[model samples]
Target: MRKLVIAISMLALAASAAFADPILDRQALMKERGKIVGGISKVVKDEEPFDAAAVLTQLQALQANAEKFDADALFPSGSDTGDTTAAPKIWEDMAGFKAVEDKYLADIKAATAAAPADVDTLKTQFGAIASNCGTCHQTYRVKKG
Candidate 1:
């Protein structure tokens, strides 16, 4: 009985960790993206000195995350609860949502390749990337107060 209890307890813990809420997962991912972009934005806004190398590194990280972002897996069905900002339309119009996601990923890839050398170029390229994010949020993300 003692051994069986321990095995069940371990299994329960593993299952819970393995099935962590998808909403939380996406939220954390978005926060990371936001932090990276925010760092670049500060430089572009002249709030910080423009460092091409730093910008490139941050953009690379964003691109890496974008490349690995799998909405279908991360935004699983019935995960639009908790603190999720995902709208119901995501599950209803999955293809449309995916199209937007694809565009964002493409924009990130382009930005990574461009590696804007100065604030002006960074603004232009990063503007497109930011716009892509806004477009998706407008359609699929619920506003949070």
Candidate 2:
């Protein structure tokens, strides 16, 4: 029984070590951001009624997500390896990478202040932020299958 327990514990430790913590953390943050965007997207798509308050809440969450992201902490050296989709360009031009995130935060701030009262306004705000996301992904992400 003691030997079996030791073997199981060793397996658990190895399994946990298989994925680097930073990659996992960053991936989780991105996934949450996607969900927040999806919630707002439903309103933009007319799949859900335009509730300015609800949209504002989601926008706020997005703002928090942007605020919480620290590029250096999330993308440390050697984090580029493993199963990450982060482009090498991110490491090469960290300033540029940070600029991209800064632009995203600015868009969020602008959108929050505007506080869209209708679908059209929300669409415009969404477009600005979405465009920022697209730009970053294009320059800083690699599509790994």
lDDT of each: 0.88, 0.93
lDDT tens string, model 1, 1-145?
Answer: 9999999999999999866868767877888989988998898789999999999999999998887688877898878777777899999999999999898888889988988888999999989889988898899988989
Model 1 lDDT at residue 136: 89
Q: Go through the candidates in order and give the clash count of each.
A: 0, 0
RMSD of each: 2.5, 3.7
Stretches off by above 4 angstroms in model 1 are 1-19
Q: Which candidate has the highest TM-score of all?
A: 1
TM-score of 1: 0.87
List clashing residue pairs in candidate 2.
none
lDDT of each residue in 41-132, candidate 2, tens digit only: 89999999999899999999999999989998899998999888999999999999999999999999999988889999999999999998
Clashing residue pairs for model 1: none
